[model samples]
Target: MRIHILGICGTFMGGVALIARELGHHVTGSDLNIYPPMSDALAASGIPVRLGYEPKNIDPKTDLVIIGNGIARHNPCVDYVLNQGMDYISGSQWMCENVLRHQHVLAVSGTHGKTTTTALLTWILETAGLTPGYLIGGVPKDFKETSRLGAGKYFVIEADEYDTAFFDKRSKFLHYRPRTLIMNNIEYDHADIFPDIEAIKKQFQYLLRCVPSNGSVIFPNSDTNIQDVLSRGCWSTQMATGDESGWYAKLLTPDGGAWECYFKGEKRALIKWHLVGNHNVQNALAAIAAADSIGVAMHDIEKAFATFSNVKRRLEIRGCVNEVTVYDDFAHHPTAIATTIDGLRKKVGEQRIIAIAQLGSNSMRMGAHGDALSFSFQAADQVHVLRPEDKSWDVAAVLKPLGNKAFVHDSVADIIDVVSKAALKHDHVLIMSNKGFDGIHERLLDKLSV
Candidate 1:
């Protein structure tokens, strides 16, 4: 079958296209914004990607149109499909009918850490020789491609709570009937779609309802929001992290490079890795619990964790030059920003941690987090925020509590200058954004080189 995808450059939809191509389907896609590295990956896979949405991009031989959530109903291509009466389905729905239905799906979902946990779990399975199929939101450093169809029975998915498509209001994870579900932690996010935290929790309830009774659900006991979602009613076997009841972890060192796992208070395995932060420790715990449901031995899990390569853009060290380290991270949300900064702070310890953040995500741009965002950056010695011109919220007003510690600018160049000046020889610069912050990481390095 021939499939043409709309909004194919996004991580999720791009992964779908790769999987479709791997399954022997002729796949082509169109997106308004097409650039590397997704563009490079798709082109390397022999899949043709059109530059933008146009009625003419739809091939006469196309069997189906798989639309991504990024497309709206009024889009020209969508209107063309509707006017032509062509069959169209969402990315998640297409996967449900074609790929996920055939695999033992293991889904990792949360407001944060989904990509890393999914990558870690997939690597663990791969290291154990499971050769599991996977569709992660970002490219794992260990894999050549972001999505693949392996010979193993298990399929790992970085399940999202976001709505499936413009036509479907259901969360994308609902289409993936997971045998092992990891609820890393939940916080109010996607303020554009969800009106409140409870609305997001309700969606989680619906996802939990889909799990079979014999399947297992793992979450952090430290997250009260997750506990509230589970309290609504849970039928599947439950595992908890940060508590001794089901599965938990203990850090062997204050630096967070090594950790020990426990299952119901019994020592399981000691894992040592380069990944930093307590959040990553919790992510590892969730992945371990999910792996256990698939009957993977603790020793194998430990081995995989020791060598696991995290997904790109999650605290990825872009470069280190002249005793200064620059990191690229996808930390648009308040909690994610806090966690990423905290991890870096722990690693460097009193060494200056300079942060370059942008109001990229819709929630952050609208100032949905308000003063909460200011507190998230307390660990940093100084923060430079890229405040876009169109935002109605007063970025500086909200960050006023930080006083001289915070600097807000409407220009990317200004933020880069501030970051470069504030950063010293031993400092660590964390560049945080969900979208590309005007390629600030490399640009900062160039400016600092002078």
Candidate 2:
């Protein structure tokens, strides 16, 4: 089938494009902003891509339009497709019919850990010699690809609860029709979309509604937010664990670098993943439960986790020079930042942790919860707020409470200068942002390399 993807540059949609292309489908996409690494990845896959989205980009040859969640009804091409009554569905819906309708869909959904968990699931399956097809929001560094259309019978996906698209008001995961749903955690997010935490929980309820009776759920036992939803009643089989519960991770120290965690549970020491932090522990436990259900032995699962490199930009060490290590992470939320910091603190003990974050995500830039930015930076010895004058949010007001931990900076150069002046040798400068922050990591690396 010939597939045209709207908003193809988005991480999720881009993976769809790559996987579709690998499946021998004619894949083409249009996005207003097109650049590496997404553009580079798409072009390298030999997929035809249109520079900008317009109604003219669509025609009779297009069999399906994979509308990305990022593209709204107001988008010219989306608006045109809607007006013409064309055959179009969301990325999630399209995946439901084409990629997962008959396969074992291992769906990982949560306010956190979805990407890491999905990647962990894929890695265990791969290391255990199962070539699983997968679509992840973040590119798994080990595979170097976000989507792989392999011959594996299993399909792994990071099941997000965000609304599918403008046409479909339900969360994207609803259309996924998951056979196994890994409910990690849930909380308030996407302020512009859902009105309250309960409103978002309702979407989760709907996702749970779609799980077939034979399917199961894996969740953190200690999360009160998760408990609130689980109390509502679920007929599907379930597996529960917390950081300190039945299935848990014991952090194992490795060499000078890297983190190893042991996944011990009632039946086995299922897995020991190389990823760090409590969040990753939950990620491994969730993946372990899914793997156990699929017949991957506990010990082999542990070996897979022992060597599993994390997804790219998720606590990825970009460079180290003059004893200062720079890391790039895709953590934009407060909880995510805190967890990432905790992980780094353990790995690079006693080093001053310098964190630089950008208010770049739609949720961050929307200004609805600007104050939360302060809480996100509490772990950094010194914090740099990129694009604080983002025009959408009151940056100064948000940083006011943080006092010394936060500082508003316009460019990457400014951040480098502050770090050089204040941070001592062996310090860890961590850069966190979902969107590429003006290629800030490389620029910082170049400055640090000198």
Candidate 3:
């Protein structure tokens, strides 16, 4: 089938395009922002990408139009699809109807760690020679790609709770039927769409309902948020979170990047992971449980864990100069930021934990999480918030309570200048945002070099 993807520049959409292209479909796409590496990625695949949505781009001969959730009712192409009555469907719906039916899908869903956990789970299966097909939200460093449409009975995907499309407002994951579900912890996110934390939780419950009785859910142990949703109903579920959890994880060496995790407090898997958070320990466990359910041996999982390359931008090192290391993470939510800090603290110890965070994602930029930003940085030695370029709120008011410990600046360049001037000799500078922060990591690395 010839498939045209709307909003192909998004991370998820770009992944879909590649996967569709792999499926031997004639894939064409259009987006408002058509730039590298998405543009470069598509061009390499011999797929022509158009700029901006136009009715003409719809191509009457196209078999199916895969509209990304980012597209809405008003796009000119979308309007034309409606007016002309073209055959189209949401990306998730398309995947459900064509790709996932009758497949044993190992679905990973949560506000945080979905991409990482999905990558880890897929890695375990792939290492065991399972050759599972997968559609991860982020580019896995191990694979150098996000989506794979291969010949395998198992399909692993990062199940999202966000609305499927402007037309289908239900959570996207409901379209996915999983024989095995991993419910990582949930919280308030995408405030632009969901009104409250509970609203988001309700959607998660809906996702949980999709799992069949034969399928078991591996979830975090101590999370009250997960507890609340599970309390409402019963499902085939298991636990994997804390020190005393059902499926426990043991870290062999506490030294920074290398970790050996034990399930049930007995040595299970050993790996050197770049991710720096206890939250990631839980992420690893979720993968272990999913793999065990799928018949992958513990020995193979341990080997895959050792060789697994981390996901892109989750804690990616952009550049390092002078005496400081400049790192990047897509940690926009307050809870995510706090967990990132906790992981770094475990590694760096008393080294000045310099964090430059941006309120860039939809939720952090305009939610009731003004106070969350302050509490999120309790683990950091110094907190610096990039005064939102979005103008979502009075930046001063939202961050005023942090007082002398926190500083809010209006420009990424200004934040770089401050960090460059005052950072300690061995400080680790963390640049946190869901989107690129005007390439602040590069600027800071350059300044620190001098």
Candidate 4:
């Protein structure tokens, strides 16, 4: 099969390309901006990628076109496909038909932690000798590629709630009929697509409708939003984390690098890992429960957790220069930003923490989280926010609550200059964004090194 993917640089679409290539398909793709680690993975796999969405990029011999959600109507490639009467399908639908249908899919879904939890569950299955096929939204340090066709019946996926494609407005997760579902705490996000939190919940309610009666759904016990969605209807066996009634974690350390796992009031295992944040502890509990439902033993789960390296861009440390460490994190939402900062605060303990953030996600740029954005940076000593190009909201006014602690810049160059000057020994600079942030991490590091 010859396949051409549009918007192929996106993490999810890139994963789909890798899976298709692994299946012996001749796959090629094109995107506006291509960067690692997806670009690196694609190159290593010998899959060719074009620079832009030009109509000429699509090969005449291409048998199918898989469209990414990021690619909207009227893109030259999209119009070319339509005018040429070429067969087309969304990445999610193609994944469902080509791979997920044959495997027992274990899906990790939510506003945050989906990528990490999916990588964790996939590693758990791998350690148990299941060799489960998986598709993670981001690069996992432990895995060679973001997606693979394993030799086992299980397939783990980081299920996203974003719309499938311009043609199909439904959430992408609707197509992944997961047997084991992990609903990591949900919240209002993707404001460009969803009008409100209720709109997001309605999509989750539909996702619940996809889970079978024999499958299991795991979630944090304290999340009322998840509870509200479940109230609508659910046939799957329910497992709640962060409480005594279901899976729980007793944090042995404040940073969450070590913890004791519990299941229904009994000790299951002691998990000591390098990952931080209470959110990750909750993610681990959910992964444990889902793994248990599939008959993976507690000891094996403990072993897997011990060796879990975590996915890239989730509080991943990029480098340490002159005793000042720089971390890269994929935290765009206010809730996620708060949790990530809180975790690092606990880890560093009174050390000067500098946060360089970008309002990169559409929701942030549209002011969906503006009210709570200022509060999310309380833990950081200094907060520098890269002003969005949209200019729909006043980034400076939104972060005004932080007073002198916050600084808003119109360009990545300005942010890099300010942060590089402010950083000192023992300062932990956490750069938060969903996009590349114009390669600020390396540029800032270079400035600091000089």
Candidate 5:
């Protein structure tokens, strides 16, 4: 089968293209923002990717058209597909029908930590010799690529709550009926699509309805929002992290690398690794419960936890120049920003945390978080907000409550200048952004090195 994918540069769509190629289909794709390393990955997989959407890129002989959520009505290729009555399905729908249908899917879904948790669970399954297939949004350092078709019956997916496509208004996770679902805490996000928290919650309720009675819904017990979502109705078995009865974790190390895991109050095994923070600890617990539910031994999970490498851009250290370390993170939400900073704070106590955050996400850029953004950065010694050149939110005014602790910059150059001058030895320069902050991490490193 020859499949043409529209908007294939996106992480999810790119992964889907790879999966299609691996599944023996000749896959070709096109996107307006066709850049590496997704483009490089597609090229390596022998899939030709056109730069932009046009009616010609649709491939007249194409067997099926997989439209990415990023594609909308104005796209010439989309218009052609609709006008010609070409068979089309969303990227998520294609995966559900072609790939996931044959496998036991384990989906990691939530507003935050989906990529990290998905990577962790996939590693756990791989370590247990399950050889699980996986589709992750970001490139996992453990597995150099984003998606693969494995020999095992298990498939691990990073389930996103975002709409599947312009035509399909439902959350992408709805199409993925996973046997094991990890709801890793939910909060209001994606201000462009969702009007309120309840609107997002309603979508979550639909996701819960898809799970079979034999399946299990894994989540952190501490989240009231998740508790509210489940209250509506949950037919599947429920597992909770941070609770004594279900599945819980006890932090041992000060850096939060070692955890004592218990299921039903019985000591399962001690998981020790290099990942930091209580959020990661919760992620580990969710993975542990999900893996154990599928019959993976606790000791095997311990081995996987010991060797699990984090996903790229999730607290990934870009470099250390002159004793000033620069870290990259995909933390755009208020909760994620707070957790990432708190995690780093645990690692480097008393060291000046120069938090360089980009309000790139729609929610953050629209000033939806308002004063909470200031509170999210209270843990950092100083917060540097790289105001998006396209969006005007008056971050300085939004962060007025923080006074001099917060500084807003109009350009990346200004941020680099300020950080280059202010960053000192032993300072942890944490750069947080969902998208590339105009390559600030490396540019900052070069400046600091000079």
Candidate 6:
């Protein structure tokens, strides 16, 4: 099959492309302003990616067009395909039909930690010799690629709640039909598509309906939002984390670098890994439960946890210059921002944390999290926010509660200049964003080296 994907640079769409290629399909794609590591991955796969969404980019011999959620109606490529009467399908639907239908899908879904949890579960399965096929939203340090066609019958995917495509408005996870589902915590996010928290929960409620009766649903006990979603209806066996009644983690270290895994009020294993944060501990507990449901032994899960390297950009250290370290993280939502900062604070102790953040996600740009943003950075000694070009919301005013501790900059250059000057030895600079942030990580490292 010859397939051409629209908005192919997106992490999900890119993963689809890779899996399609691995299946012996001739795949090509087009997107605007392409950047790595998706671009890098696509290039390595020998998949030709055309820049921009020009109508001419679509090959006449293309057998099918797989549209990404980011590509909407009236795009030149979309119109071209429609006018030409070309066959089209959304990426999620195609994934469902082509790959997921044949495998025992273990999907990790939530607003945050989906990527990490999916990667962790995949790693655990792989270590157990399952060699589970997997699709992660981001690059994992433990895996060579974001998606793969594993030899095993199990397929682990990072399930997202975002709308499928321009044509398919349903949440992407609705099509996954996971046998084992992990709902990590959920809060209001993707404000562009979702009107409110209830709207997001409705999508999750629908997702639960897709899980088979024999499957298992793992979640945290303390999350009222998840509890509310489950209250609507659920058929799968439930496994709760964060409490003694279900799978739980007894934190052995303040930073959550070490923990005792417990199931049904008994010690299962002691997990000690490089990853920190209570959020991560929760993610690990969920993964352990899901892996256990699949019959992976506790000792194997412990071994995998010890060797897990984590996904890229989740508090990954980019470089250390003159004893000043720079870390890259993919934290956009208010909850994610707070947890990430808190994790680093616990790990670094009293060392100065210079948090550089960009309001890159649609929700942040629309000021949906404006109120909560004020308290998200309390763990950091200093906060630097990159003010988006959109003036609809006042970034500085939203962060005014932090007073002198927080600084808002209008440009990447201005932020780099200010942050480089302010950073001192033993300082940990954490750059947080869902997007590339104009390659600020490398540019700031260059400035810090001077």
Candidate 3 lDDT over 262-381, as tens digits, reads: 666677666665555778887887888789877898789878877888788887778767678888998988888988888888888888888889888877777467877777888777
Measured over all alpha carbons after superposition, the RMSD of each candidate to the real structure, in angstroms, is 1.0, 2.7, 2.0, 1.0, 1.2, 0.8
* Candidate 4 Cα misplacement greater than 4 A, ranges: none
TM-score of candidate 5 to 2 decimals: 0.98
Worst 10 residues of 3 by lDDT: 249-258
Measured with C-alpha atoms, the lDDT of residue 251 in candidate 6 is 86
- lDDT winner between 4 and 5, please give it: 4
Query: Largest lDDT belongs to which candidate?
Result: 6
Off by over 4 Å in 6: none
Off-target runs (Cα >4 Å) in candidate 5 are 389-392
Q: After superposition, how far is residue 413 of candidate 5 from its true place, in Å?
A: 0.6
Tens-place lDDT per residue, model 1, 1-450, is 999999999999999999999999999999998988899999999989998788999996688999999899999999999888889999999999999987899999999999999999999999889999999999789899899988989999999999999999899999999988999988998889999999999999999999989999999988999999999999999888888887777888876899888988899989999899998988988998888888898889988988888988988988887889999999988889999999998898999988889878878877788869899998999888887655577888888888898988878988877777767789899999988778888998898887
For 224-308, candidate 5 gives per-residue lDDT tens digits of: 9999999999999999888897888778987788879888889989989989998898888898889999999988999998898
- Residue 295 lDDT (model 5): 97
Against the correct fold, how does model 4 do in TM-score? Answer: 0.98
* Clashes, model 6: 0
- Candidate 3: misplaced stretches above 4 Å? 237-240, 243-245, 255-267, 270-272, 389-392
Worst 10 residues of 6 by lDDT: 386-395
Candidate 2 weakest ten by summed lDDT: 254-263
> Tens-digit lDDT track for model 4 on 178-248?
99999998899999999999999999999999999999999998999999999999999999999999999
Deviation from native of the Cα of residue 152 in model 1, angstroms: 1.5
Tens-place lDDT per residue, model 6, 4-89, is: 99999988999999999999999999999688899999999999999999999999989999999999798899999999999999
Q: Clashes in each model (backbone N, CA, C under 3 Å)? A: 0, 2, 2, 0, 0, 0
